[model samples]
Structure formats: structure tokens, C-alpha cells
Target: MARMISAPVLSQEKRERYDAFRQERTFNAYSVGNDTVMTRIRHKSLDCSPGCAVEATLQLIDGKWKGVILYHLLQGTLRFNAIRKRLPNITQRMLTTQLRELERDGFVLRTVYPEVPPKVEYSLTTRGQTLEPVIMALKAWGDEHTTFGHVPEICADMKGSPTNS
Candidate 1:
């Protein structure tokens, strides 16, 4: 048998705050025994003034591996090992963590097949697909600005500029 716990009562002010917060953000709530836990799924904050919108967007894809993961997913669905192969530098644990976070935030869909060893596939969700332009723009920027083993043209031009002094 398992013991159950009841949710604590919130004060009137606290309740109002809770409601407001819920209105601004998306969350998934589940019960652990009898206690309810709210997990944040997205940070759609009501305050999108000035840099807040950019901040909220960044919060969604902030992890180092997230953008790269999404970029690959844009090509098509891939298995866990395939994704790992593309990101050779990432550890298995880190990849798992980033995938879970992306799934939690509605950016990735994880499908598991009941098989002898369990087959798992990950693909981007519709919400995740919406980031295609942003991701591609980032890729374009990197392609133009990144120089693998040589100085970038921009750096060479800056070397002789007044600011370089």
C-alpha cells in the first residue's frame, strides 16, 4: 500500500498569483502519489516588451546541443544513435537530457516501439518545425562567418581598421 498526500491550501493572494502565472506560461501537471507537481512546458511569459521576447525564445533553445539537434531533425526523423553519431562530441547522458528537455517543451516528439530492445525515434513537433527559419538563418550566418583554420575575411578587414588600433 502507498500513502497519499493532499495538496496544501493557498492563500487568496497566492491563488491569484498562481492563476496569473499559469496564464502567462504553459505547464504540465501530474500527480506523484496524491501530490500534484507542475512541470513547466513552455515559458510564454506575458511580458514580451523590449528584450523579453528574445529572452523567452532563447530560453526554449538555450542548450548548446539543442539548436544542432533541431537542425538535424529538420532533415527528418532520426533514431537516438543516429543523433548521437551526428553530435560526436556530446556524451550519451547529455544527449538524453537535451532530448528530454526538448520533448518536454513541445519541440520534439519521442516515439518508443515495444520491441526486443526497445526502438526509440525522435522527430520535431509542429511547434519545433516553426523554428526552421531561425535555425537556417543561424546556419547561414555560421557558414559565412566561421573559418575553420584560417582567419575570417571580416577579421582580416578589421585588422587594419581604426578600431583595431
Candidate 2:
């Protein structure tokens, strides 16, 4: 049988207990003789209200560029410069940093090719691909509300129709 660990509730007693447990749990994970210590053990927790899935989701894809990068990757894999071209406003440094972060978070994969100049490509990993529906939903919402774009023909056709009314 498997045991399930439920999320702890955020309350005064819980916070105090957590704090006490954290303090009690701290120790020198590594030590050199009696004078020096290399590392200390610690347990970190996100002290947030209950049911904070939105916060968790935002932590994974909150930045201005991550979602955009993910959106572009949804089409297929692209080289570094190709992604950069899609988001012209992003600096090379920023793009590189965002890609690295995404790759670190298991949402993007970086593949390097053995070539003269060392070609590099970025694509969504399987975990990243799970975000497709989210990206699509966001795109659909943006398409409906953004001022710079017009409604799709299908939407336009239905706007004033009897069923819509």
C-alpha cells in the first residue's frame, strides 16, 4: 500500500509547529574538525494559504518570456536564433537566461548538435507539452479580448446570430 501525504494547512498552530520542527531539524550536514562546517541541513516550505495552485502554476511559467517561449515551441522545435526571432523584443541575454530556466524546470529541452559552429535547438519536453492546453486556452482568451486583433470569422459569424442572441 502507498501512503498519501496531504498538504498541510496554513494556520497559527501549523506555522508554530512548522517553525519548531524546522529549528529542531537543522544540523550540520558536513563538518571539518571542530572549527569549520561545510553545510547545514534545512527544510524549506512555501508558507502560503490553502489551495494555492495558481501561485504554483505561476512559479513555473510566470515570466513575460516563458509562456511566450512555450507558445512558440508548441508549433515544433526551433533553433536558438529562431526562438529569438519570434520574440524580437527580448534581449539575447534575457532569452538565454529564460531558456536556461525553463530547461532547468523540466519544461524545455536543450539539444546541442555536433557541427562546425555547434548548433543548438530548444523544444518542449513531455512535461512541457502538457502545458499545450494551458497555452491554447490563454491564446483563445487573448484572441477574444485583445484590442489590436479582430475576431475570427467563425466568431464574427456567430456574434449576431440567433443562437448567440
Candidate 3:
């Protein structure tokens, strides 16, 4: 929906509504003949914490399997097979892809050992541990509003019983 913006709205002898909107928007300052400043909308600052860091965090751990993988990884080191066992719904290819991405993003530490069957374990990095509180809070909120209408097994550990009980 587009409205015909009045000429007064564009004037520097401004209006409260225009000022409020200008303050909220990000713009590029422009100079006209050495005496005026202009603003334009463009991509937000990459250094913005929530815009960048938060997005990076979500990128590393967002999606159906990523959170589940992080949840399992929080329980100390676990091998690839162990993660697979916990997240049975995820396809093998996707699980591998998510782990690789997390590892690349510094959210996970992957260790491999020389063994006949080839053992590889994944655990959280220091940066990854920063997500514990976030993930736990999400877990807490989810437990409070479970679609299952029952406490999750993870919550069961905290209170020593299911939510209903």
C-alpha cells in the first residue's frame, strides 16, 4: 500500500511524525552542494550486536536438527553415532552437514581418534557453551508450553519428575 506523501512531510521545517520515522530508520547521509545532509535506507550495520552476532548464533544453531544436536552435545562429548541415536528424525546427510557448519562457525568442537571403527566425538566450544543459557531458556519455555502436554525428558531431570506429576 502506498500513500501520496505530502510535500510538507519532505520539508526540513519538519513534522513530529517525520522526525520520529527518520530517527527509527537507518540512512546514508548525503551532502548537496556543501550545505545539506540527506538520508537513505540501506542494509543495517553489520557490527550491530543483535543484527550480526545474534544472527550468527541463530545460523549456527537454528533449524530442526541443530538445536537437538546442541542439546545432546551439552551433555558432554558424544560420538557421531550418539548424536544420531538422539536425533532419529534427522537424515544422516543433514546431520553431517549441520555438524560441519557448526564446527566451521566455532560453535562446536569435533575430535577424531584412531580406532578400528573410527570414532569421532563432538562437544561444545567455549563459544558454544555461551549458548547453554539460551538453549536452556528455550527448553524451559518449551516445557511450560509443550505440544505434547507433558514435560520433556530433559525437564524431568530438573524437577525429578514430569511436569504433570
Candidate 4:
């Protein structure tokens, strides 16, 4: 059964604890600087909070661009510019940073093809694909309740788009 995890917005303490958990995982990730770390420590579970995994989920996906990124990826594999077109307000830097984070967190697979300039595209990894149902549910909730009907276009004009005209 899916673990029913309803965590609050990440508090500073939780973030600190999560960092500690990450450090612990890193330290415990290897055994005394050996090349076969996982071979030795393969069976042990890292020390984590009661709901650390769930907490990590909220932290990774609840940010401004994350949900949107995941949502568009649900539609299909999308190039960086396609994502930018969907979210005209996000700066190129911000989008780049978010994609990097998602890749780091194993939720996004960024494929860079060798081409004229560069051909880069992003899609949801299996782990990320698992999140579609949950994200869609959240989207449905927002669509039904948000005063603006939760349309991206409705919010698009809030700042009149981010690019310099």
C-alpha cells in the first residue's frame, strides 16, 4: 500500500534534519574509502526521519517551477524551450537551475544530444512518472478550488510575462 504521508510545509528544523540525514547517507554511503561501498553496506538502511522520504517529496516538488515542470512532462518529452514557452515568466537561469535540481533528485532525466548547438531534452524518470497520479490529483484540486481556475494563462499576465519585450 502507498504510505500515507501528510507532512506539513517543511520547517527549518526539518530541513536541517533532512540535511543531516543526507550527510549521514553520504558518510554511510561508503565504507572507509573503498571502491566497493555498496557491496559492504548494501543491506543497511540509512538513519532517516519517520517520514523523511515523504518530506523530501514535498521539498522537491512543491516549489514554484517543480510542479509545473512535472506537469508539462506528463504531457510528453519536452525541450527546454517548450517548457519556457509554457512558463514564460521563469527566467532561463531559474529553469536551468530547477532542471538540474530535479535531475539531481532523480526525478528528471535530461538527455543532451550532440548536435549543432546542443540538443537537450527532459522527461520524467520512472520515479518521476510514479508521481503523475498524485500531481494530477493536486492539479485537479487546484483547478476545482483556486479562484483563478488554476489556469496558467490566467496567472501569466500577472507580471506581463518575464522576458524583456
Pick the TM-score winner: 1
Q: What is the lDDT of residue 14 in candidate 1?
A: 62
Ranking by lDDT: 1, 2, 4, 3
Candidate 3: Cα lDDT at 114: 92
Cα TM-score per model: 0.63, 0.61, 0.60, 0.60
C-alpha positional error of residue 118 in candidate 3 after TM-score superposition, expressed in Å: 1.2
Give the total clashing residue pairs for model 3. Answer: 0
Q: How accurate is candidate 4 locally (lDDT)?
A: 0.75
TM-score of 2: 0.61
> Model 1, residue 20: displacement in angstroms?
24
Clashes of each: 0, 0, 0, 0
Residue 131 error, candidate 1, Å: 0.5
> Candidate 2 clashing pairs?
none
Per-residue C-alpha lDDT of model 2 across residues 1-165, encoded as one tens digit per residue: 999754334468755865664544234232333212222223244445554666577778978899999999999999999998777679999999999999999999999999999999998999999999999999999879885543454444435553453
Give per-residue CA lDDT, model 4, range 31-134, as digits (tens). Answer: 34332211122214534556666665676786689988998898889999999988878999999999999999999999999998999999999999999998
Worst 10 residues of 4 by lDDT: 34-43
Stronger candidate by TM-score (1 vs 4): 1
> For residue 158, what is the lDDT in candidate 3?
45
